[model samples]
Target: MTRPTALSVALSLSLPLAAHAAPDAAVVPDTTRDIDRVQVTATRTERAVSDVAATVDVIDREQMDRHLVQDLKDLVRYEPGLSVTSSATRFGLNGIRIRGLQGNRVRIQTDGIAMPTSFDIGAFSNANRNFTDLDTLKRVEIVRGPASSLYGSDALGGVVAFVTKDPADYLKDGKDSYVGLKFGYDGQWKGLLGGATGAFGGEHWSGLVNVNHRQGQETVNKGDVRVDNDRRTAPNPQDRDGRSVLAKLVYAPSDTQRFRLTAERNEDTTDTDVLSAISTAVPTPRAPLTSGMKAHDTQDRTRLSLAHEIDALDQPFADSLYWQVYTQNSQTRQQTDEKRTDGSRRHRVFSFDQRAYGLQAQLNKAFTTGSVDHALTYGFEGTRTEIRQKRDGYQVSSTGVVSTTVTPDAFPVRDFPITTTTELGLYAQDEMRLAGGKLSLVPGVRVDRYELKPDVDSIFAQDNPGLAVAQLKKTSVSPKLGMVWRFADQWSLFAGYAHGFRSPPYNDVNIGLTNVAFGYTAIANPDLKPETSDGYELGLRFIAPAAYVSLSGYYNDYKDFIESNVNTGRNAQGLIVFQSQNIADARIYGAEMKAGVEFGELSPALKGWALRSAVAWSRGDNRTDDEPLDSVDPLRGTLGLSYDADAWGVELAGTFVQRKKRLPPPAVQTNPNAPAASVYQPAGYGVLDLMAHWNFAPGATFNVGVFNLADKRYIEWSAITPGLITDRTLSDRFSSPGRTLSASLAVSW
Candidate 1:
């Protein structure tokens, strides 16, 4: 089959098909007709989404299948105001930026449990954002703005919530048991993926299980044609494997009460050259030389949770209640061996392990007084986190001479110490239905108490007494208020104001540093203040049987912004080190719009046709630094037209991005051989994508995608930043994947 040009594809809207979204193998899920039907996260209660005052975009299962994302970064491709920083290919430290904030500012929750973050030394990668498997997710929701009223800390920017699949979602009222299997492949990665799912039920009990595995595949990038061709070394090219398994059981002794137990495990491992880049172009007398860099990275996790729920029950003043207790453990280890070409040999090993346990309970009650009906919800959540970081190795001279002092075994070699973090939050929210259900008034408040403590080894204490001292504690109170006014049966106006806060993470406060080779020493800070944010948004929505539209704008003001590093300079070893501190303030603002129309409703002859579009624009100002925020995403827009038939469908989508001209000059250059301090700014571009599906038989389906149909090679701004580099290659940006084809097939009975 031949693909059309980007222009021709962009003009294919009149061709007719499933116009709402891409089809998965020949089927467009019927459930999508109920886009605004129901949601629980918005108000912590099961209610029609149209009644909520917040903006929540739910990526349903069908949509997930269409994207076929292999990692978390791919999930934001078609969405607006969401982008991931690609970092260098070597450490591959990538992160997602929502609106204008990322890192700790954005909270990642899996089934309501907070996930952990990852940070590495030499490679400079944040492996934290790539763990979750798409096969395990039933739906993903992006909630923009500070959600401190509901989730407390790590919610200054917003929240990304992941909900796993449930057997009940695929079961029928009379079905007792069912089994299914699926297999998929992508051209870019050249890999095979397979999974199995099963469910069985009885009068009082039911169970579900899903197991998925991706053997191994290396993601291929577009051919080299960027400003920086190959200045720095990239990670051992993409060889990796991953697996995920989940099991859930539900028991109901009566109609109104039930209990559920769920267990999940995920694992990923990679063995490749950690640092294979070498540049002899620079004058080498003062430069440290290396024979080669090789490493092995392995990350894994296991989680168990038990929950209880009660529906409209025989209670006094309460209507319902929900509670859960969960525990999770995860680890990331990297071992790299290096040989100096100059004659000296340097070897290193590092590991990060975290254990977390938490409890959550929520109570809901509905009552009416006079003209207003009230739905009140109260909840309390707590999490205790323990982290252990270890690093060991010996330094060597530039030449094959003598190996310097070996890394101490008894002393703490980690950037951070043995640490413990505990966070407790108590919150309550009330939804008032007034004016005969034409208006909703929501008021909520949350109180949070947090503490961080660390233990230092004698080796650390003897070298840095002030940095090895003790603990940090903080308390925060957050309030939220929102209102919605219904002017017409199908139109509503809403507005909200919320307060958010974030505390320093363990790594930033106490990354232990003792490098005698280069002569550098860093200490932990026991007294760091929290960062605070105030946000405001106003929006209008129009919903009807044939169409939907939403427009909104938001502004956020932050105080005492906690910058990860305030002072940067070379240590005794000549290695760069940073000390943490707070800045005066910062601000970000943005606007968003979404609209969809069903052409079938306008004309009978155009049945099964529709069109959809979404656009986002945002900007950030780091006032304290007097510069534009590099993390802020550029203006983006997506336009799509689709045709849906009973057993087949096709979709054509186009995404356009505006170039970013706002940027700060490069960092201050210190060492002569070190990378030149400069910024990686990207130019904007547009691309087109094509997808089609066919249901060949009863339970069989076929789907295909012509990615980058125009064969245009574009660069993602997030993927180019060097992220504190020691070498400068002058690469302006990271080029995305080139033209590729992808298809998948599945069957079940």
Candidate 2:
């Protein structure tokens, strides 16, 4: 990645207003001093985090400014239940696991729009863009646990929503302007610059626009032997450049009615070279060299929203109506070369492109049951996603001979074809208050109709005739129940039980016979059952006048969990490669707690300061097989203390992660020659961080920080070493950037 040269800056400045206002908002002035309360979209409706029915974590602008958090991974340390794993390249698109569940189970959104690009096989890798870049953000909200009833598919684990900054949120009296810049060195060169502006009539309308760019060089590890040849501190060779533009517009005719439109685009390019150690039967050990892996990815999104609140309805059954529509387009391409000492060489080129469109409308009604308040929420949501890929396979022998196995696949491969999935969901949730607000019962149900269509599936016709001749469709209904009892202002208890389901991905539901008519071995199964799970949870929330405490515990039981399996227990060329099948029951139980105190409560000397800490302990096991779940961390926690004065603020924080015990893959028809085993176990480690913020002037500020104070070595997960005979090595490991330093400056008027 290259730095933003003067030529690039001039080009950006020369763009016309039409190009800059592609989305919907306008740049307003004086936007930094308004709206102390932050609203989140965790639910269809807007509400404060503390009032939400579920556990929610809010990452505010102040924190983003203080930490210079440029991406999702940077924010993970502050979130109690969120964890991210990824390579050094920001283009690698980190994976987020919430409460031990990973992959497509979690729902990610921008504002109220759904981002459903996790359809490609490599989509889990470096095929998608991360939801970061602070120039266009207002705040972020994370909701933990099954949210299927509200979000539909892909919400089996949890939901993360990136709420873009609205012109109104940043503007003061609906008028504000601001510019922010960040510069840092993390054993490597890193820099960032961005700005935003807000302008609008106090109560009628508002608009905003923002742009930012970031660049950084690769980093190395200290005394790390995993990648033998790459002796540099940051051997994984990486360079990145990203630029984004966002615009928003809103109209509010009255306090009860509002309309909004938003648009954003992000373009980024990345280059990375990967090297790993390998030893074979040869005299001298040879390490595989992965050279010239380059990728370019882009994301564009647009949304339109409308909301209205009414107190004049003839009946008490209706209180508000809201409607929203959003669309997203993302494209990613990766070109790679692999070389090994065994004389085996391969050239791989692949591109993943996806488009998703969704629409949702909801009605919220309030009424009285006995002397208690009852609210009913009902909504309809529809989503359509299309995934397309183009990839070529190549192989070359040690004799300097090269052959092409296959060229780039067309729009739709004949065997697997292009898959399109569409879903329609109808759901309703009821929240009833009893015993003078001391007890509340919330129950929800969602019915979803899903249809997966493949353009062509000739290879699957031999086993199931329905696949090649036409298309297939599947659907399921999910339900949820929960209750909360508020004993006092400082003490509250809650419990919940929810049922969720997941349909097999189109590429993994093969069910066929011997190689035959379709020239392929396996077929597609139209009758596959949806994977299901039931979960029970209990929690407590205690908030005193000057302190806060939160605790939660949950037990989850799963049935028909999808696991990878080989159809015929034999590997033959041109065979239907893999299928998703039901596996034995699994259970996960864990506890999480976070507490904080206001220094002012202890004594006057400790005024203007605060202290906070959090810890989470989780364990998952396949009860039927008596084995731990892969990638499940046994223990994790964070401790932090901060102080603030009229002119400055400072904070110190530390994080700890315990080792992970490896486990086998989901399932198989029968055990193979070698049973699956653990390759590496990551040892526990800790690091400290420091941050300081100073208000230099009425509208000027500066922030400085140090990350990875100890430069400790650690690993997040394990990966396999590439070679003729693949070995294993832990990934996402490093000797922490060796005490990096960062600083930021900002001005607003």
Off by over 4 Å in 1: 1-28, 31-37, 91-93, 225-236, 274-276, 282-288, 394-412, 458-466, 514-520, 568-578, 671-678, 722-733
Global lDDT of each candidate: 0.71, 0.59
Candidate 1: worst 10 consecutive residues by lDDT?
14-23
The best candidate by TM-score is 1
For residues 564-632, could you state the per-residue lDDT of candidate 2 as single tens digits?
433433345554434445655777778888788887777889986887788888777766567776645
The TM-score values for the models, in the order shown, are 0.89, 0.82
Minimal lDDT window, size 10, model 2:
14-23
Error of 1 at 559 (Å): 1.1
Task: Tell me how far the alpha carbon of residue 572 in candidate 2 is from the true structure, in angstroms, after superposition.
Answer: 10
Best by lDDT: 1
lDDT tens digits, residues 1-749, model 1? 00122212211221100000111211225436424745566667765656778776677667666666656666777888887765545445455678878876888878788888656444422346556787887767778888888888998888887777765655564778878788888776676788888988887898889999886554556544322223533223556777899999989788777788999999887666543343344425544454466667778889899988887664765777778899999988766666555556666667778899999888888889999999898888999999887655666665445443443222335567788999999999999999998999999999999998887866455545456545888999999999999989999998999999998788767766544443445556667788899999999999886898888999999887765544467656475555566655888999988888888888889998888889999888878778777677789999888998989888898889988777655554446787465555566889898988777886677778888888886667667652333233434225676787877776766
Taking all chains together, the TM-score of candidate 1 against the true structure is 0.89
